[model samples]
Target: MNDLRIYIHIPFCKQRCSYCDFVTYDDKSYLMHSYFKALDTEIALNRQYIEKSNITSVFFGGGTPSYPDAKFIKAALNKFDLAEDAEVTIEANPGTVDFEKLSIYREAGINRISFGVQSFENDMLIIMGRIHDRSMAIRNIKDAKKAGFDNISIDLMHGYPLQTEEGFRNSLSSVVDLGVTHVSCYSLKVGEDTPLQSMLDKGLLPEIDDEKDRNMYKAAQGYLQANGYIQYEIANFARPGFQCRHNIGYWVLDEYLGFGAGAHSYYNGRRFSNITVLGEYIRSLNELKLPEDYSETIDMEESIKEFMILGLRMTDGISINVFSQKFNRGLYSVYGNEIKDCIDSGLLISNGEKIKLTQNGLDFANKVFRKFI
Candidate 1:
């Protein structure tokens, strides 16, 4: 059987973060029951695809996956006949989960728990409109550990307009103290039309300092690596054997199916996404039709570009032999000039076996990625 991954989007949350632009709603709890029914219909619609593949991983992500009733989450998971070693993960916000709820998820077959603990700073949390304080974040993680979750990951956000270097450092130290298995540190992006963006527009918040942002990013790499976490992807660090398999599947361009409103899929040589509008999604799925709003066939040329681009996101980069084997074309034949340009600029290093980003490349990765396109 072919290897596959599945992603289920839960678009409900207690409160929306100020900087978030994802397609999630805080006032949609009333639609939770209807949405899961539509989600079940969508999964049933894709039953043939699921039957033919051995699903290796599943992820529940969203506004806050833990915000929903555990039964709905468990009911959705029961639909998949996953691999015995499948890595099932849920993206949880700090205040939305408790010991009993976490234990329910564990019993439902979720093996990995990724907490969206954006920061451990009370001021930062308040500014970001996060409902959880530092204490709550810590307690939730301890609760997850106590619930028998050994493979745990936490997300940290830095470079916000009001985030301080010291606060970021302390946040890193706390993760070490918690002894979680994985970490994903990311820089803040002020989404357009978001509350955070409005604050910037009204001069209520200061503009983020680019230099300080770079320093914080570098610090996370340095600090996390020193603390025994391997920087596997550009933004993700993990202890041994604990890398997020579901996300890695996306990076490597594996075939996967997605469910729920606004979820995306790359299956059957097509890239497509469901309707972002919940009503439309539910309506279409109820009619026994797939709720696709946008789709495109990934041709050879587009596939090559995506492979190189996504592969380069990881620290190990892409393999030359695998590229030739998979695409039946030499990597140099397709990206000879682009590769040379990145290497000449000291952004990428190519040993014949593989080509990966250099330390300098990490900072200017967007520039190097542009060369390939």
Candidate 2:
């Protein structure tokens, strides 16, 4: 049986963050019941795939999964025949969940909770338009532990407007002190059409300097590594044996099925995603039709390129033997010149069995990724 991973997107949030451009609705709480019904229908419609696969992971990612009732999460999970040790995770916001709600989620089989604690500084949180203050963030982390989550992850951001290197380090220290098992630190990017971009345009927020961003990134890497967290992926760090398996599956190109609005899926070399708009997703499901907006089969060349790009995201990099076995082509035969160029530029290093990014390459990851593209 195929080892399948499942992702369910909850497209409801109490409010949108300044830097977010994801497909989420801030005022759609009233549609919660109908949306859950549509999701259940979508799951039932995909029952054939579910039965033949050993569902190994389930992730509830979203606008704010904790904003809705935990029972809705349970309702979606009931449709799958999960493996005995599935890594079930839910993404939550700090201000939305309490001890009782989180405890109920634990009972509903959520083994991991990833909180969106962007920064521990109240000023930075305010700048980012986060709903929770630093105190609430700390309280939520403690409550997650009290509610029986041994595996916890929190996201921290750096390189944003008004955020100093010292402030970023302080946030990292606070997360480490919280004793969470995993940490994902992302550098803030001012995405186009986001409120952050508008602020930058109007000079309401200072433009982040490239050199400062790099320095902050290096600081985070150094601090986390010294504090017993292993840099398993470029942006993710974890204690021993606590790396996120679901995210690792994505890096390794595992077959995954995504449900609900705006969710994407990859199975048997085919890639597809559901409709992004909530109303359209619900309408299609209510009419007994699949809400797919796009689908395509990945060809050999595209697959090889994706393998290199995604696998290279991991700190351990890609295995040459596995690549050869999968594609029936030696890695060097196809991209020997590119690999040689990257190595000569000190962007990549190879110890014969595998190839991975060097520290400098991590700093210029976009430049390295562009080479493959």
Candidate 3:
């Protein structure tokens, strides 16, 4: 049996950003007692999924996991059956973490910390409606290190409304200089129905230029790679042996359970998502029922399509042998024409039976991925 991975969503934030659409709110006064009870019940019901006592990774993502009280976090962690060496990580905002909370989380079995340091520029931080300034983020990093947390990752973003290439580089350099083990850099997307979309429509904010976004991404890749960080995923770079095991579990299509409002889980050929609305989530869970509002069991062709699309996102592409083993079919027999066509088009390369994206393919990754989709 494959080791199970766990994801716990902390669906609260000190404030909501302007360009955000994630299922989180700014209210601090939520039904904490009721929420934890529901979560505990869900955990007990789903504990049977961890066959062979195999639980390898646990990730705490947001709203902002660090935004809550430390005691609440400790209480929540006590419910799970975590492996001794499991890669336990918590997502944190800069100002939300302190030495005391860090100690508490570490004591509670969290060994990794991923900080949301979107930018090191004060102006950009304000533009993004982030609560922490550059100083607070830097201080948090130092304090975390002082608290004996070495395995750390930082999240940064590019292509903000008024961001420049120089400004982006400065942010990257600052984090790199801080000596984090991993970094995840993502390009800004102006999704439909987001506050950013409204701003763009009203001419309050300029539209995101695709070319500029591409340039920034390429620059990030070059700079980070030059600094000895390997690009494991398209948006994630890590020091040797320090890749995010939890996220890699997702990209590799490994089984994981999602617990919290708006969380999604995939296991036993089924994918289900919890309710996105907070009130609805609490209501369903409080009633001692699973909060799965949407679900789909992936089929053969859809599974293959997802395999190709997601596998290409990693620096290590898809393996024909692995595919063959998975489907009990020959790789050439199944994807011979498609593979040959992609290779001829200079979008893919083959190493033995493993197929991966070429540099050009990575640049136009969406197009390459869409071929399979």
Candidate 4:
């Protein structure tokens, strides 16, 4: 059977974070029943395609997956005949989950829990407009552990407004001390239309300097590496075997099916996404139709470019041999000049077996990626 991964987007949250631009509704609890029904319909409609594949991982990502009752989560999982050892993960907010809810999740076949604990510092959390305080974040993590979640990951944000290097380091240290298996440290970016951008525009929040942001990122990379967390991906660090399989699938160009509103899916050489509007998504499912808003099959050139772009995100980089084997053409035959330029500029290194980013390249990854584009 073909290896496959699945993602379910839950677009409900108790409160939206200031920097978030994901499609989510805060006061849409009244739509939960209908949403789940639509979600179930979507899953069932896609069952035939997945039935021939060995489902490896299923991720519940969202506004706040754990904000909903466990029954809703269970209902979603029930639609799939997942592999026995599948890594089922649910994204949760620290303030939205408790011991009871976590226990329900554990009982419902969720083996991994990823908490959106942006920071362990109250001041930082407040500035980010996070719903949970430091205490709540810590308490919920402990609660998740006690509720039988062995594989836990928490997201930490760095380079927030008014954040100092010391503060960012402290946040990393605190999460490391939590004994969690995985850590995803992200630098704060003010998205367009987000409250954070408005804050920056009105001078309510200070802008992050480029040098300071780079320093903060380097600090995380150094600290996490020293503490036995491997930097498998740019922003993700994990203990020796705890890398997020679901996300790794994406970086490796593995096929995945995404369900629910605003979820994107890459499968059968084509990419598609569901409608972002909740009402439309539900209405389409109610009409017994797939709620896809857009889809396109990528041509060979676009596929090759995307493969390189996504593969370069990993620290191990891309294998030239694998690229040639998959594409039926030599990697250097197409991008030999670009590769040589990057190497000469100290952005990439190749041992002739694989080509990967150097430390400086990691610092200026965007510049390196643009070369492939």
**What's each prediction's TM-score?**
0.99, 0.99, 0.96, 0.98
> How high a TM-score does candidate 3 get?
0.96
What C-alpha lDDT does candidate 1 achieve relative to the native structure? 0.93
lDDT of each: 0.93, 0.93, 0.86, 0.92
For model 3, what is the alpha-carbon lDDT of residue 213? 78
Better of 3 and 4 by TM-score: 4
Per-residue CA lDDT of candidate 3, range 247-348, in tens? Answer: 988877888999988899988888899997777777887687889999999888777877888888998988888898887887778777877888999988
Model 2 scores worst on lDDT over the 10 consecutive residues at 187-196
Q: Considering summed lDDT, which 10 consecutive residues are worst modelled in model 4?
A: 204-213
Q: How well is each residue in 1-373 modelled by candidate 4, as lDDT tens digits?
A: 9999999999999988888888999988899999999999998898799899999999999989988888999988878888989999999998888899999999989999999998888988877788999889999999999999999999988778888899889888988889999999888877789988998999887887888888999999999999999999889999999999999999989999999999999999999999999999999999999999999998889899989989988999999989998899999999999999999999999999999999999888898889999
**Model 2: residue 150 alpha-carbon error in angstroms:** 0.7
Q: Stretches of candidate 3 above 4 Å error?
A: none
